[model samples]
Target chain A: MTTSREIRLKSRPVGVPTADNFELASVELPPPGDGEIQVKNLYMSVDPYMRGRMTDRKSYVPPFELGKALQGGAVGEVTASNDPDFKVGDIVSSMFGWREAYNANPRALAAAGPMGGIMKLSTHGMPPQAFLGVAGMPGMTAYAGLLRVAALKEGDIVFVSAAAGAVGSVVCQIAKIKGHTVIGSAGGPEKVAFLKEIGVDHVIDYKATPDVTAELAKVAPKGIDVYFENVGGVHLEAALNAARPFGRFALCGMISQYNETGRPTGPANIIQAVGKSLRLEGFIVSNHYDLFPAFVRDMADWINSGKLTWKETVVEGVDRAPEAFIKLFSGENLGKMLVKL
Target chain B: MTTSREIRLKSRPVGVPTADNFELASVELPPPGDGEIQVKNLYMSVDPYMRGRMTDRKSYVPPFELGKALQGGAVGEVTASNDPDFKVGDIVSSMFGWREAYNANPRALAAAGPMGGIMKLSTHGMPPQAFLGVAGMPGMTAYAGLLRVAALKEGDIVFVSAAAGAVGSVVCQIAKIKGHTVIGSAGGPEKVAFLKEIGVDHVIDYKATPDVTAELAKVAPKGIDVYFENVGGVHLEAALNAARPFGRFALCGMISQYNETGRPTGPANIIQAVGKSLRLEGFIVSNHYDLFPAFVRDMADWINSGKLTWKETVVEGVDRAPEAFIKLFSGENLGKMLVKL
Candidate 1:
């Protein structure tokens, strides 16, 4: 019998989840039923938003149930298939659980499902790990949130927080491709340098800057036209103050306060959003599932043409997944933090 | 020479203006020049935004200069005219000053000028004072801010704060006309009653409701889709919490904290905006000048068809203009407040 190692939620976490909140165990893997495929996990993504799912509160998506395997975006290779569409050796990405190996029901992970069931990975120049970072959920998020929700235009100035992270990094690159002047904020000088190397016009080390608004103003003399919000609290307040009249703010994530026990202090200059006629919108990448094919095509073209570059911070083993996820909050990862089993 | 009583700004106040800030004096009304028109001011509008003009700081419009006549949206009768477009005994509205009588450079308020100046008013179907309130800047503000900026649609739920005030009252009425479920919050029971009489689906007296967000929850079980923001502070905070996912907020004014010495306390749960994917936009009516003609037509139709209602709290005499303007901040006036000369 095949065996799979799974990470299950032990309890609802109060604050930054400790290792005690999760339990790793091995279980017997069931043989694939008709129209199903057995997937051997390759890479498991660790994102900030997964922290929200750890709680039992009502959110855009349901919370993770205790004693259940923690689920997230994952890329795997099909080892066995009863379905004609997916053959052995075929690589695919799905919103599967944190498991070393499992049988994936074609219907459950199929592209026709509401939860954006599994899809075949593009056989382009980009690596399969890019499916979890750029050209995946994060890349689609930057595209939809910036171009669709934020309504970004050429010559607009963009300010992206958490610039070295998965989503923010792609947002900066997409904004640049659209002919926008891009400025980014990251936790350290190295990530800031990385952002600058990847076509970001300016980079602000948020840790080094005492006054975020002032630092943003110094970089964007004409003022920020588009603020791609990822880290909330002080960053959001600073963005509000620095935003020009009629600016557009894309509310993507709030990594700064995600691991807190209670609600974090929100922006203090929110009234400025009203006076300046700013547009702030929050969105989920799943809402734009219709655009995935279009996104993959464009992203592949960009990657082939040497227009877009991506980096992955891969944790070597499955046992390090929890540690890698926790490190995201501490700003330890330079790019997309993933666990390779 | 014809004698006219005029009120001018004697000095700029640091915070709230006292009687000493304004000077009432008699001035000689000169005869109309080549293209000038002599207007006998019948009613002078007193609006909250005039307070912003009292400060030396630059805003959407320039501040009212010290020792100069305080200009506002006013309606008057043309006693004499040298321009062919305007005739004697014609009642018109313009950005005239707080005066009993004055001569206007007809070219300054003409529909089409060398520099794209003000448009002349047509007093065909309703009260002349309507030109300053429901059919003027405030009316256009409610129309454009809601329709264009907020992208308000039929069947959407709406919430308006300071519901009995000039802009809010008009906003509620306009939303109702567009087939929206309208709820409003006002400072007193009387204003709440007025809001209901004007077709608001629900009314909350903010003075009585200690937790405005809780009160909003009871009334708006589905949560608000379009929020016409006028009074900021706790009300804004409540609105943010009560807004549904993908809701849109049109930030028009913040009367609640306008007089505060420093930056007003912003919304505490602004991070919720990211989760809900809400859209908040700040706007000025002056920026939407192109929508004026369409606004005038729709407002006139509503008025003539008895589909819309309005209230005017007229404070007689030009000397009472300052007190009338101050009453807006206190929520003492119902609907549009005007000072009759």
Candidate 2:
């Protein structure tokens, strides 16, 4: 038997979660059964969607049960394999996150599923941790959202909220590469600088601007054609006002109001969609995972050519995973927030 | 010179429009110019969407400017003609309404463009008044919103708000015709009775039900698969609660919110879309006019076979057009409301 340290959901969170909501424990793992493998985690992803699982609501993904080990995206090395398919040294990614070690059935591993948000880590001349950040879900989200949902047109002006964050960063970069003018909004000077360095035509430091909608209108005078929605609330309202007639919104997440106690008031200007014929659609990365092959291949080529760049805010240890997740709400971390085990 | 009485926007209304907001005027009309024909108005439409045009705001259709004739869908006869293509006694429809008579260029009558929304009236064994309701924009809205936008599957459990209204009534009947069970909600006992007569599986008298969401939950225990949103605000909140995962919302209009002084707090539970992976798309019938030929054929067949039936609330004379349009917000008009000139 092997002992592994793991974090589990202690209780359902009411609004904002605290350390008391998660319980750390030791679990004794039995030998890997037939067609099963044991993995020693190298890096784990702490994402916004994980916050939804902490609550007892019926969402696209199941809520984390009390006293049970929590799961998400994790990249690890195979330590022990009963099946010949999964060798001891093969690098793999699974939905069995929040743990230092895990035993999983090889059958549950695929490119897209509840257990396999993505299965094998396509190294693609990148670091193993890259599978949890830029080269993985966040990266694919931006690719599919822009190309498929927003329907990026040539010479189109695009606006992205949370431009310094994981998904937003990639979205802004891809829009620029596709010959579309890009406008990005971030919370601070460093993030704004990062956006500028990445070739964004215009950047808005939302922290410095009192009226984001007015500022967006000023910069995107011709009006935004595409808006990648990461943060909701004020961002949606701003997008609504800035977007021209027939603009498309690729809505992936709404991190801003995930922890609200009462019902979150949506954009006051949602009615604008009716007037402008704006198409606002919410999507999960799982729905577009079929594009993974093309995404990974294109992303690898882009990285090698120095056309794509990324950042990771790593929190060292499985014990600090909860803290890393909380930091996502406070906007403390830059780029993709990850936990290095 | 010919004289015509017309209704025009006096000033933008603060909240609910009153008689004071509209001006009754008589205009002197010149003879029909080259390529133009004179039309004697017979049946004019007073639709809920016309309320949106009353506001001095940019929309899919231009606002009804102050001190001008308010234009909408009107079917009339060519009393006088200068164009060779148009002959005397030819029945036609144009974007001329809220008046007794007018002279318009024949180019404005087409199947599809800015001028295309106003088509040459096609009465297929149905009354000319039928062209204003069941065989016109309202009917096409119901057909396209279901078959295209909402993507209604064979067994979809449809929930339509304002189900006794023009578009909603057609939406409910179409859902039933496609082998789906339906629940419809409308104000007062008369509208509810009308819905039941039209083969709705269940009907809710919304006026009597204080908690619409709770009432919806009771009727649609299995949950709704498609929501045709004609009324926004409380109805939208109820639909959000009743909708199942992956449900689609065809947001054609929001009549409940057309007359608000301040911002109307939209569906408080709109974030439910994110969780349910629900898709909400607002649309105008003009965008899908290609479906008109198919729509008219199928609708005429349905009406002839008695598989479909319709009702219209007629407020006679062009003088009462404003009062007829106001009836939409008050929910006084049951089926397609019209003004007989």
Query: What is candidate 1's TM-score against the reference?
Result: 0.95
Model 2, runs deviating above 4 Å: A30-35, A108-114, B28-35, B107-122
Query: Candidate 2 falls in which docking quality class?
Result: medium
What DockQ do the predictions score, one after another?
0.62, 0.54
The TM-score values for the models, in the order shown, are 0.95, 0.95
Return the clash pairs for model 2, or none: none
- The CA lDDT of each predicted structure is 0.84, 0.85
Which portion of correct inter-chain contacts appears in model 1? 0.73
Each candidate's interface RMSD = 1.9, 1.7
Candidate 1, lDDT over the whole model: 0.84
Count of clashing residue pairs in every prediction: 3, 0
Q: Give per-residue CA lDDT, model 1, range B102-178, as digits (tens).
A: 88776755545422233356787677888878887778888898888889886789999988888888889988888
Cα lDDT tens digits, model 1, A126-190, are: 67778889888888998888888888987689999999888889888988887889999998888
